[model samples]
Target: MEVVQTIAELRARIKTYRRNNDQTVGFVPTMGFLHDGHASLLQKARSQSGLVVLSIFVNPLQFGPGEDFERYPRNEEQDLAVAEAAGVDIVFMPSVDEMYPTPTRTTVSVSEVTTRLCGASRPGHFDGVATVVSKLFHMVQPDQAFFGLKDAQQVAVIEQMVQDLNLPVEIVPCPTLREKDGLAMSSRNVYLSVEERQQALVLSQSLQQAKTFIDNNVSGSFTSEELQRLVSKHIQTAPLAVIDYVEVLSYPTLEPFEHSHSITTLIVALAVKFGKTRLIDNLILQVRK
Candidate 1:
């Protein structure tokens, strides 16, 4: 894969791709520590577009105070190998200096969609996410951009941003890839201890339980409050896992869940911290009347 660090070089290459090559370009932006979830996104992009561009930049803008910014994790060699193996035509790896030589004055923020769940737990988190993703969208200028649904809220925020700003790129969200044991694949999973890793399954388990509750409650007997408590209680069963936030929001808009009295789609999500590692997992379910 062709790797470029500077924005100018990357833009020049993209220009060449657009002018000379008639192939459609797909972009997958990610942090350095890639896993199966990321690979799934790359594979989706590769299948849909003729040329796939993968970006590996750990944006400091998105990380908050006491968050894992410095010790997030990085193995450039391994990431490159994985990207190439996944059929990435170009890999953009820019340093902090290259991405932000001067302090960034402009920042993108999506309201309501980012106001709850992980957004409330980590203030300015979505701002950083939106800013960097907006920058990447502008930089790559791909026909389509791919993201995993594991970050359902992030997907909502980005989609809103794209629509509000009228960006031409199509935002394609791929399904979340899970571990054989049920844990959602994450870059931070490496931070977990053997015991903590097992404890992390509660996130996914709670999601499944939420689905079961929806399946059983045909009359819409359970409220969002009950679902939140159910998930929080489930996570608490694992002492190592501390609940950050447990919420069931209306899908897409992410409005606070009020009633399940009828057929509706709800996004059941949770953010839990096992020691210093904060992990997020979610499930989307349809309720029938």
Candidate 2:
């Protein structure tokens, strides 16, 4: 339950904790506006490490010029309560001024994998994500870090970044937490109007439909283009669900499948606009006999 604002203070606190040989640190880096999905990450981090550190900073670098950077949710007091309840040992809630004292000229960018799905639409979004995540990894210096699979591509990107940079921390991926209706839990869920929210169920429902297709052997012969059309058709049926991208690709590599390979796992990932709020969800299927 200690809140450390500056990096120097955080380093000192971590130094004190490291002096004890038995302690292992776990870090969860997030933008504020806490939700159960974020809580799941914190709980996982708490369970795995001797001390859990949660950092809440809505990084401005990650947002494109027209994105919701200015309007992104923030409830510091509530976030602190949620983190404390989830057994976070240290809450590193740094201000933008503290994180970027001057303008940042250097940026961390990942290639190939950054050009698809959410990346294709948002433009420079993953670069911002990669840069900030690298900064957090440096700032926290934890043995293990937790991330939710809700952003599956993000998890893949961070894994690649860690491998490329040889960062000492392990990137732990947690499953996406969903609502009773199957919509993935996100802070942006608040932006959905009641009507838009209801229509949003199509995102997950279509994934379920795709899963059913796979489960029943109907998807075995479905080409990637056909699969994308199938999911897109279902999503568009709901007037409120505007398709951003519906793609089927190799699981972790995220390369599009030229043909449905028997040995490769398929990722059915999609992003849809429910009114103005963009929601994303995916289904991972192993092609097996």
Taking the candidates one at a time, how many backbone clashes does each contain? 0, 0
For model 2, how does the per-residue alpha-carbon lDDT over 1-289 read when each residue is reduced to its tens digit? Answer: 8999999999989988899758789999999899999999999998889989999999999899878898898899899989989999999999999999999898999998878999999999999999999998898899999999889999999999999999999999999999988989999999989999899988888888888877787546667776787788899889878888999998899888776754368889999887668889998888754
* Residue 236 error, candidate 2, Å: 0.8
lDDT of 2 at 95: 91
Best by lDDT: 1
Model 2 root mean square deviation, Cα atoms? 1.3
Root-mean-square deviation of every model: 1.1, 1.3
Instruction: Estimate the TM-score for candidate 2.
Output: 0.97
lDDT of 1 by residue, 114-205 (tens): 88988899899999999999898889999999999999999999999999999989999999999999999999899999999988888999
lDDT of 2 at 150: 84
What is candidate 1's CA lDDT for residue 3? 95
Clashing pairs in 1: none
Angstrom error at residue 289, model 1: 2.8
**Estimated TM-score for each candidate:** 0.97, 0.97
